[model samples]
Target: MTELRDVDFFRDPNSVVSPYSYMDDLVQNSPVWIEPNYGVAMVAGYDEALTVMRETETYSAAPMIAGPTPDYGVEFTGDDIDEQLDAVRHRLPFNDQIVAMDPPQHTMRRALIMGLITPKRLKENEDFIWQLTDRQLDVVLPRGGCELVDDYAQPYALLVVADLLGVPEEDHPMLLEKAGVAANGSLTDTTKEPPKKHGGLEHFYEYFTDRVESRRREPKDDVLGRMAHATFPDGTLPEPLEAARIASNLFAAGQETTVRLLATALQIVGDDQGLQQKLRQDRGLIPKFIEEVLRWQGPIKGNMRVARKTTTLGGVHLKAGTQVFVMHGAAGRDPRQFDDPQGFDIERPNVRRHIAFGHGIHTCPGAPLARSEVRVTLERLLDRTSAIRISEAHHGPPDARRYDYLPSYMFRGLTKLHLEFDMEA
Candidate 1:
C-alpha cells in the first residue's frame, strides 16, 4: 500500500531513514520538480534552492512553518501576488511571527535577534558550553550507557539556549520540563491530537512576556534585557508580546534544532570507532565534522516558500501559491555542488558552502551558537569518554542496525539514541 517512487516525504515512514536515493532521483530529474502526488514543487538542486532563497520578493515565506500545505484563505494570481498574499497573511497561521513575515516586518523583527548574538556574547557563551558539557557528561558517563537524547542532548541544548537568552537560573527546571520533553517531544511527534506546529514555543511566549515586561521596568545588563530594550530600526519599541514571541522563537526553536545536530554528531561517532579515535587525536577536525554533519543530516529538512508570482525555477514554471519546498538535505548532497556528495568527507574543502543555515537574508542567526554547541560537546565528550559505542542491545549490530527517527515532516532527528560509553579515569 506504500510506494517509494513518487514518494511523499511527509507520509512515507520508510523514507525517513533512506531518503537520499529518492532525493538523488529528484535532483537528477530537475531542480524544482512538482511532486505528482502533491502539487508542491520540491527544490532538490543546490543552485535551484539558492535561487528561491535569494529571490525573496518572488516568494512568500508564510509557508515556512505555516503548514505542510498552506492556504492563504484567498486565491493568488497574476505575475505578482505580493499584495494579495499580504492582505490574507494574517489569516495564515502565525503570520505575525518572524519566519512568517515578509520584507519590512521581517527585516525589522530579525534585526532585534541578530543584534543580541554578538561575537562577545557568543565567546562568553562558549565558556558555559564547555563547562555544561562536562556537567552533563558527569551524569551520563557514570551510568556507562544512557538514552543520549533524553539524558544529555535535550537538557544540554535547552540550558545552552537558556544561558544565551539570560533565562533566570531558578526557572531552568520548569522550562526544561515544559520545553525539553513535553513541548519538544510532542512537536516532533506528528501523531499528537492537536497539531504540533510549534506549540512548545507557546510556553516560552508567556514566560518571556512576563520577563520582558520586568526587564523594561528595571533594566538589567543581560541578553534578554537588551532584547527587551531593542527597538525597530525606526526607533519604535516592540510591544511586549511581540518581543516575547521573538525570544520564544529563539529560545525554544533554536534549542530543539541544535539538539538534533548534537544527536546526529554523537550517533556518527558512536557508530564509527575509527572516526571517534580520529577526532580524539585531532580536535581541529571537530569543526569540519560539525559542518559535514550539518550538510549531510541537516536539522531542518525542508523550508517552504509559496510562489508569489508565476515564475520559472530551473526551467520549471511555478504558478502563484505553489509551495516550493526547498530540500536542504537534498540540496546539500547535490553532486553539482560537492565533488563526492554522498560520501561523508570531513575534509571536504567547500563544505561550508552548504546552505544548512540557508544562503540569503533569511539565514538562521543562531548558526554560530549551533556550531559551537557541537564543537564543545564533541571535545568534552571525547575527552571524558575512553570510548563511545552504539549500544548493541538497543540499536542492534552496526551492519544490521535499527533506529527510529522523529516522526515529523520538517525536522531530521533521532527519536532516541542509545549509547554505551567507557569512563575516562
Candidate 2:
C-alpha cells in the first residue's frame, strides 16, 4: 500500500480496495485537487462535478477513457481545442459508444436509444425480474447459503437484461459464458503502455451485429427488428454495427450495475439485524435503502472527464484538454452536499437529489432497471429468509471483519459475499 498522499488512483490497486479514505483525503484537501502524478484534476465535490457534467461544451466526453495520459492522437496549443479533439475522435477508445461522443451526435444517439427503456418496457421487465429472482433463490436457498455475487446476482442480472433486450433464449447461455462484465481496472491501466486494446462487449458485438443484419433481411416485429431500422430524432437511420454497439453496451452495463448493487445491499443486510428487521417489516423502506446504498458506496467509484476548453470550476482554473476524474462516490460523501455525509441514512430527506446516477444528459439510463432489480431481489430474499448472517468463516467476526473488493478505480463492489440464511419456518 502506498502512502495516502502518494497513491495513484489509476495504477495502485490499494485505491480500489479502500478508496473511501483516499477520497476523504482528496476532498479534504480541496474539491478539485490536481494530482501531480498524472496531472488529472480529481473533481471530488458535488458542485464541481455538476459544473463538469452540465458544461458539456466546456468539458468533452471525448476523453472519457483517458488512461493516465490519454492520447487523443493529436495535439493543439490554444484556448479552445474542441474541434481538434473531434477530428481525432476515432483514434480514442470507446469512440463509437454513446459515452465518448460530444454534442449533436451524442444528443441524437441518446434520443434514439431512449426508446429501449420505455415505461411500459420497464414494467414488463420488473414482472420478469421477480420470477427470475425466486428461480435463482430456489437453486441456492435449499443449500442454506450461497455466494451472492456469482451464485445469484451475476446470472440473475444477465438473464434479466437478456429478456429486456429480447435476446433469444438460446443465446442466454452464450452471453452467460462469454459476456462477463469487463473489469474497469483493465481500462485505465497505467502500468501498461499506450495502444493497448480495450476489452469491449466481445463476441456480443458481432452477435448483435449479425442479429441486426438478419432482421434487415427478414423483418420481425420485435425489439431487435425495431432497433435494426430505428432512426435518430432527425430521421437518420443508424448502421447495423452502430446499433449493435448500443445494444451490447446496454446489456453489459445493466448486468454490471445490478450485480454490484445486489452484492452491496446483501453485504449490509447480512450483518445489520436491526436494519434487516426494519426493511423486512416496513418493505416500503427498500427504495430508500437502495438510494442510501448508492450514496454510501456506489457501484462505480468515479468516472473520468476531460476539459474541452479553458474553464473554471470550484474556483480553480483548468486549461484546454485537461483530464478530470469526477469522483461520484466522493461527491456523495461531501459534507457540503450531504449532512453527516459519511453516515448511512435510508430516510435522508433529500436522498433523491444525490448524484450517484450522475447528472445531466449522461446520467445512467439503466438507473430504473438497476433499482427494480435490487428491490425485487432483496424483497424476495427477505421473504424467504428469516435471518441472514455474514459468513464469519469467510469474513471473520463482525467487529474485525474482512472483505474483498473489486480491483478497479472505476467500479466499487465486493468481489464476493458469503451469507448464511435461516429459512422461514
TM-scores for all candidates: the values are 0.94, 0.93
List lDDT for all candidates, in order: 0.82, 0.81
lDDT for each residue of candidate 1 in 277-341, tens digit (9 for 90 to 100): 99999999999999999898888887788998898999899988788898988899899989888
For candidate 2, which ten residues in a row score worst on lDDT?
181-190
lDDT of 2 by residue, 1-425 (tens): 14776878887887777888888776766888888798899998888888888988888887675565777766666889877887887887787778777789889877877888788878888888888888888988998988888788778877887888778777877666565432211122234434424444656678889999999999999978888888888888888888888877676567666789889999999889999999989999999999999988889777778887888888889888788899888888888878888788999987787788788988887889899999998898899999999999999999988899887777889989999989999
- Top model number, TM-score: 1
